[model samples]
Target: MIAFTAAEIADITNGRLAAEPGIIPGSVVTDSREATPGSLYVAKPGETADGHDFVAAAFDRGAVLALVEHDVADAAGHNYPAVVVQDSVLAMGALAAETVRRIRAAREADGQPLTVIGITGSAGKTTTKDLLAGILAAEGPTVAPQGSYNGEVGVPLTVFKADAHTRYLVIEMGATGVGHISYLADMVRPDIGVVLCVGTAHAGEFGGVENIALAKGELVEALPATGTAVLNLDDARVAAMAGRTRATVLGCTAQSAGDAQVRAGQVGLTPGGSPEFDLFLPGDPNGHHVSAKLIGAHHITNLLAAAGAAHAAGVPAGRIAESLSAQAAASRWRMERTERADGVTIINDAYNANPESMRAALRTLADLGRGRRTWAVLGAMLELGEDSIREHMAVGTQVVRLNISRLVVVGREARSLYVSAVNEGSWGNECVFAETVEDAYDLLQAELQPGDLVLFKSSNGIGLRHLGDRIALPPQAPGRTATEGSALL
Candidate 1:
């Protein structure tokens, strides 16, 4: 973040300042523990906790100012140094928007272009952001979200991490409603936009799958006529977004999509379960063969989207392929692999799960579990709306068809999966519902053999990723119980 005085912040956020005019904050933060000297702590209210309760702690930790909805007084009965706004989260957005504008102007005056890429989709937003950031950072200073920080507050926090020295800014946009992406785009004003795909990850909140398409398309709709919109030609909903944007279209596909500018041919998975394909760029007849370090064949869509965005931002196709070939899964629990000394391989993709990602992870598990016993510890896929039971049953059917050796379905929310597997001819101990994470852990501990491959997958809210972490450890490594880990998460 650029240097800003208390008075400047008040003016930018349309808030009333209680602090001294000369006080300058070095950085902005929401968590009090992250507060440092000259840091501006945001006292924003959350679901279970109120930020106002932590203002004193933040001040004690060297924070110079607080952005709060109300003035918080010290023990001495005097108000603490702060900027009082109607809403601290919205104020954070204002500060973030101004920060981007200042950085953009500074880079332009220095005769260097600042390329901002806004990426959105129901799934793969974080992976695509990581891939693009890796490619961009190799060329210049790049700033991107920490993980899946793509919501309202998350987007602003991502921008606050940028400064005039940042040459490229990658913003991952996520939307649960129609105007969410548009609001985020107005803040960053990206030069290039990438729409990965519209899926049923949040179909409940968005009303339907078509509404998800409407929400995801807003990223491309926000692009300028002079900019480029990278559309996934492999997905019909994403490919149709080309007609929604005024910007030039750059289409990417895992297979030949006829008119797609960026394409991958000879797509297949490596022996290690990573995707390997021949990438073909526009105006280039020759294809660059790339063996990705990231696991899962479904990642081909993400790989192509990153390649198209990088190419549109002036990177050569060869360099893009090289950068991609070296990038692995940077975020946690998204097909993250761990090989234990006991000859057991744990693929932890429990950070998030939907119909699309769930299927993808299961396919990868089946592919990698060849010649070995496989265990899939799947939890609930939330927010499917009326299709919740159907989707869960479909996943169970896939598990059976894939010939997975065992199925340990955790939680009653996902009991439909166990039922479906049984109905699909998996009998007795072949598929069982553990009813709890601890029960699942005990079952696995009693039966897991060496050379077996296990996968843990669920939505973040379900906390299966923590269980995956515990399971990835050696049987005697001494870690929190699955239930305890899930509780902590």
Candidate 2:
């Protein structure tokens, strides 16, 4: 973070000064294990653990200041050097807002400009952020979220990494309900907002799919009149967002939608399942062709969203295309492709799953496994509210329609998928129900043959990604015998 004394932080956050820390913090950390010299540790509460419990460990590891809900005591019973606030997470947001103000003011004084881009959607937030970051980083010093760090705490942490020299700030915003994105946007005050498709990923928390659209539109609604809003025209809900923001609308479309500012023509996937398309930016008669390193045809929208955001940020269209083609999936487990020496191609897209992404993944699997056997080890999509069972059944039906060779549904929550697949004509050995990841592992270990393609997909909490990691290993590795591997079939 920008240099800040404990007093300054206390004032910025409307917090009270505890024991005077007489120190200037150079960075911010939430996890105590990540604390370093001059770091300000945030004692925020979590679902299972409280951050207040780690304050002392942070101090011992070289933290100079702590932002806490209550003053923490030392061995002498006196309070540790800290800034006490009503809520540490809210204080972090306050600090982040102030940090952005300072950075922008400094840049203005130097005749340079700081560009902040906010990206949000039910899916594709991280992938788009990664793509935008890749293009922006080549232009200047850029700061984007780590992994899926797009929540209240995650956004502030991302802002803390920005300094005076930082030229571009790319934030991924995620919301569970109404006003969540607005709350995040109030902190960073983005110059450009990118709204990818609003899907059913968080339909449960937001009450319904319509509410999700309302929530995701908050990012564009937060943009200034002078700013730009990048909306995916392929999604009707997102296309409707153009009217919701005062900012200029820049539409990104894959299907040659009418008058879209960013268009992808002749879209097709490479043999390896990466999207290849002709990218047409505003005023470009001749579009630049991009053969993306990302693993699915569905990523064409993400590519266009990034291209639109970069163009709004003042990068040339040619440069954006070149950067995008070279940028593979940077974050883990989002169609992350791993080819073992045994000729097994494991597409680990287990980071997170929704109906739209699940279908995209299944289609990509069908394309990639054209002449080879395909296995789909799917877990629950999660948080669909009333639509959960229907959605899982839909995915199972798609798996059968796409002609996926084997179906292994790994959890009780996702048992509907197995039943639906069998009901949809995947009878007998084609579809199997495994009560646990271990059972699925055993089933696959015995059945998977050379040239068999596998896809692991589920919500993050399902832990299917770890199973994918275990199964991706070569059969001859360490403890497993050929006889044991041969029996798994």
Candidate 3:
């Protein structure tokens, strides 16, 4: 972040200062526990906890400042500067935005252009952001959103990560209601806006599926007339939003991406399970082969989304393919596999879960379990609000349609998913339910067999990672090199 004095921050966030005349706040923080030297702890409140309660803890962590809406007459006891605001969370974002504007105006970092690509959708937003950054970086430097940083606070923080040296910026934009995407897009002011797809991911939060479509459309809606909008031609909802964008449209999808300006084809999985495909050049027979390290045919769609965004931003096709094939899975949870000592294969996709993601996971699980009995350990998807039960039920029906031999549903709400599966199928005796990760662990330990394939998935709230770790025993014997070293010693 650009070094800003208290006076500058007052101007940036349009807030009052309760501290001394001259203190330079070097960083902005949301979590008081993570605040340290030169940190400005923003006293924001959450559903379960208030950040103001931890002001003392932040000082212990060496924080230099505290940003608060409440007047801190006794901040002198903590020996740091304090900034008073009507809302600390909003002020933090305001300061971050102003910092970015100043950085961009500096024309620093050898005069390289800052190309920001804002990505929005119901699903595939993170994967597309990761892939897009990798592809664009094949030609030059890039800075991508870290994890699922696609919201109000995350968007500003992502911008703060930018400096003159950042050749490209790939930002993920997420929305639960109307105007969220527009707010993030305005912050990023991206050269290219990508609408990956619109689905029921958070439809309940936005009131309905139609509202969800409108929310995701906000990314392109905020685009300037000269900017480019990358639309997923295969998604009817996303495709419909294209006409609403003032930007030039570049469409992408699988070859069936009807009338796409760019498309991917000849796609399939290797025996090892990575994605392999050819990206069809727009208006030309010329194409480039992509060997992405991600698994499943769904990744082809993700790659095409990233490809179209990168192309609209002027990245070459061959470079995009090389970038896609060169990167490993950006994170372990997407479709990570672990082999247990007892010979059980575990796919740990427990980082997050949604209806679309759950369906795709089940399909992959079935394909990988061709010669083996497959088990699915599922937890509930969050943020669906009133639609949670129905969405889980939809996931359950899809599970029954797949080749899963057993289903262990963990957590409270996910029991609905298991029930739905039983109701949708012929009550396959393979279904079981556990209220907690520990219970799921005990059941798996007692029942798993060699040659069994198991998939564990859930939203972040379910703590499914604990269950995955419990069932994932270490290898019985060390690798040959380690054994040799032990013998020599």
Candidate 4:
């Protein structure tokens, strides 16, 4: 994203240049539709579509250069500027790494510090990233990824957004296997690494919970000796990572008494499920009490992690708590609460789901729905491999154990949940099974009453968030329904 000529980019990516050496791209893009003047388009071949097919389209949209597996001009007979490489995705990463190197160099030359913070976990990466970004932005220019852009390609795209004036970069690292996070960490070596928690979110992909811990610790492992490693004292697996990094270790916890250098005390939740707690930092006898606007008690740990990272970055404890209290949910479909005009409260947490996050959402629902009829519309938690059935059943049992009013399990993959709910003492319409989202929508429409609280949750691929969006819409007039709305539900 920093200015680079085609020749310089080719050298940075270790690829052959097929364009004039003087051509300089203003930005980088992967999708052809996002291409703008002086943009460098990276063509990646995905499972559904080959990006090489859109080379011409990208050029037509004012792209100055393209990174491809081969020169498009040779095959299509159109002379488009390109950087030929064996793999475009890897080349994009290389370019991003180089861009970060340049930004760091420029900051050092100007005698200003550039802090790169890396955050990783089985869950809560995006939420923590959003919280940390809010805290850091108060000090100077800060950049963070949009949504859940925390993967191989997404990490690089996020790094490319940084410029010379940027003081803090919050990189969310996600992994499905042992070396995934390690690979991303090598690109943007973080000065501050925050490990939220190691959970069963990707246990199946990583082979086990232990393996998930190994993958998530990669961020802390990448920190320099002078850097800071923020570890969660509550999660034993994450707490153990303190010994794995060479950086100065800072422990964060929601508990009042702990070995943690940064912690919270007198923790309580508001009626809306937002967290209120006394934030404690090192050497501070009288800590500041924070009332966060973000919903859910699960956010307590996330706030602690953000506070620890910000403290390590030289932010005052009071300012960190103040920034956190003023922050709202920046990412969609993650504890996004909406109250309908008809007195119904809809909590849409369908961005993604795993056992840990699923339980957190259920607990939040129980706490917020106290005295009101509660409905849980849940779909499958994908990538659980061997533990899928057991985890789903556990969630179903929790729904019953918590005395939630209704359990609506959508899709065949989630049938285990409904069966388990019924087996766990739910009876007579307490647990309903819907083969699709449409069926779940109809079931809710027919039975849902005023003052009911409903939660929609699932992995993003399951598409349950769309149902939450529909349910959040205002009530329609009598005998008048929008056909477009019904089509999606």
lDDT (Cα, tens digit) per residue for candidate 1, span 1-489 = 888888888999999988662468888889999999888999999999999999999989999899999989999998889999999988988999899999999999999988899999988999999999999998999999998999888998899898999999999999888899999999999999999888899888889999999989888888999999999988999999989999999999887768999999999988999999999888677978889999999999999999999999998889999999999889999999999899989999999999999999999999999999999999999999988999999999999999999999999899999999999999988898998888887788778889999999999998889888877878754764545544534
CA error at residue 73 for candidate 1, angstroms: 0.7
Tens digits of per-residue lDDT for model 3, 1-489: 677787777767778767743446566677877786877777878799988888778767877778878755445553346777888767867875675566666655457566778888877788888888877776677778788877877777677666656678788888778988777776667778988777777666888888999888888888889889988888888989888988999988785847787777777888756778888756446788888778666777788888888887787777777788887778557777788767889888887777888888888888878889999999999878788888899888888888589999998878889889889772645888888766676577668889999898898778786567556655324443322322321
lDDT by residue for model 2 over 356-470, one digit each (tens)?
9999999999999989999999999999999999999999999999999999999999999998999989998999999987788878888888999999999999988878887
User: In each prediction, how many residue pairs overlap at the backbone (N, C-alpha, C within less than 3 A)?
Assistant: 0, 4, 0, 0
Models sorted by TM-score, best on top = 4, 2, 1, 3
State TM-scores per candidate: 0.97, 0.97, 0.91, 0.98
- Residue 485, candidate 4: how far off, in angstroms? 1.1
For residue 311, model 4's alpha carbon misses the true position, in angstroms, by 0.6
Q: For this target, which candidate reaches the highest lDDT against the unseen true structure?
A: 2
Query: What are the Cα lDDT values of the candidates?
Result: 0.91, 0.92, 0.77, 0.90
Candidate 2's TM-score: 0.97
Q: Measured by C-alpha RMSD in angstroms, how accurate is candidate 3? A: 5.0
- Pick by lDDT: 2 or 3, better one: 2
Between candidates 1 and 2, which one is better according to lDDT? 2
* Residue 78 miss distance in model 4 (angstroms): 2.7
